[model samples]
Target: MSTLKNEVTAYLGNSSRIAEDWANYINHQDWTLEETIENLRQMNADEDVMVQVLMLDTMQGISTKSSEKTPDDYTVKYDGYYALNKMLSTFGNSENGSDVCITNSFTNYINGILSIGFAVKVQVTGVDGAREERERNG
Candidate 1:
């Protein structure tokens, strides 16, 4: 990628400003470049990343979930941050910054120890294909 374009894409990652810019850019008479299009597509992809996880046992499927406060240590496996945040909204009502990401590869421990049932793989997508895809490549 060109330095200028890459820098632009990096700066505009998933930002609403990108949408505005695209709206204006697409309106212009000039034809858009393919590289820019692809870059924009990548920037808006499912950027759901993982937190500190050690082991991941994959069967097949993508499930979304978060753990309730339990007597034992709570682990969270989430599909997307939006879904996870929505589920966690009522439970703890505690303050947690965005860095606390959960992934499907492994079980995630909650901040405190509690009696959690620990249900895994509640994928909003219906199929836990993302986990299977990652596991297959590795």
Candidate 2:
């Protein structure tokens, strides 16, 4: 394995499994606007948290240059960005579960103060490697 891969595995205990678990966890959650906003201030420098953010960025196509993302991927990426900016100013939790809103800051840290000190770099594959790996053992 390459140095980057070895380092990532050492810290994350298996990037593929961490990503799969994250995808499963994220898939089942009802990410409310209030909850997502609150979680942003909870960001930590833990390895697992860093890996989780890496996985999310992979899915959102921020760290990669692939064009294979589904239409929904585009929607989620755009929505997550929108939520980061728009949700903070809005009042009331009335729009928690609304489809028209962006409700996940877990993936929105790209638009926040995410630091380079927590790097867990992975190579960009030609395919939609992020989503494909999740589906393999999801």
Candidate 3:
């Protein structure tokens, strides 16, 4: 049995056949155990992101705007960020000073007037060392 299959079966208590099946699937996708674990960790980290929507109860507005970018690609020129910048710019301001805007709605929902308050929490991760190492190695 492959080491990966053995490991999977040991951790999941799956039958040998099922373990092999899963290993095959994972291999076919060109995904390693390390990458899978990293992806899972990223997903868990994402869950900690809190999105707040504060507005007057009488106002009928929806904040369906958000931007998500990776460490490698985060800028106004990026499509997601571009859209967010454009939309937020309509309100005469877009400088929240937050690293990631999970989601937000800050304009007029009912009429053409803006009237709402919201909170944006920022979580910053330092990848400079990792990025520098990668670049140096490359």
Candidate 4:
């Protein structure tokens, strides 16, 4: 195994199932393993968090492989840049659950501080608008 692989395994712990994938992903990134690890640490990406992210990546990969099939409820669009920006933002400031307007600071952080090289389309579906009765009550 490579030094990066070994170091990542040690960091994530022996029990991590996705350690190999995580290590490979890190290795392929533009940043060094140390830089990646530092960024992950800043994000508080513990074993559980890393596992969840890896699982999300796996799901996204599966979705891409089966793109010919109709998208099921399990289908997901992976956008790491968007995810990291959201994580860096203050909780509930950027649309946490229901889609809402984003603050200027949030926008600046995502575009300026993060300097993400790519763009992502975040579609919010299933918003049928408030019921007539609910609207009248307001």
TM-score of each: 0.16, 0.25, 0.17, 0.20
lDDT value for candidate 4? Answer: 0.28
User: What's the count of clashing pairs in each model shown?
Assistant: 16, 0, 1, 0
Report the C-alpha lDDT of model 2 over 1-138, residue by residue, as the tens digit: 699988965754443444444334444544432232223224323432322222232233232111243422311232344544243224122333211221233333323333222212222222432321111111
Writing each residue's lDDT as its tens digit, candidate 3 over 1-138 gives 699988954644332233233323333343332343233234333342221222111111122222342333211121233443443343223443322222234333222233222222212122331210000000
> lDDT score of model 2?
0.30
Candidate 2 vs candidate 3, lDDT winner: 2
lDDT of 4 by residue, 1-138 (tens): 699998955744432323333433443445432244344445434432321111212212111111224434213333444654343233223443222221122122111232211111121111353111000000
Question: Which segments of model 2 are wrong by more than 4 Å?
Answer: 1-8, 37-138
RMSD per model, one decimal:
16.8, 16.8, 19.7, 19.0
lDDT of each: 0.28, 0.30, 0.27, 0.28
User: In candidate 1, how many Å is residue 102 off?
Assistant: 24
Top-scoring candidate (lDDT): 2
Clashing pairs in 4: none
Error of 4 at 100 (Å): 43
The C-alpha stretches of model 3 lying farther than 4 A from their native spots are 1-14, 38-138
For residues 88-132, what per-residue lDDT tens digits would candidate 1 score against the true structure?
332223233111122223333333222212111111111432321
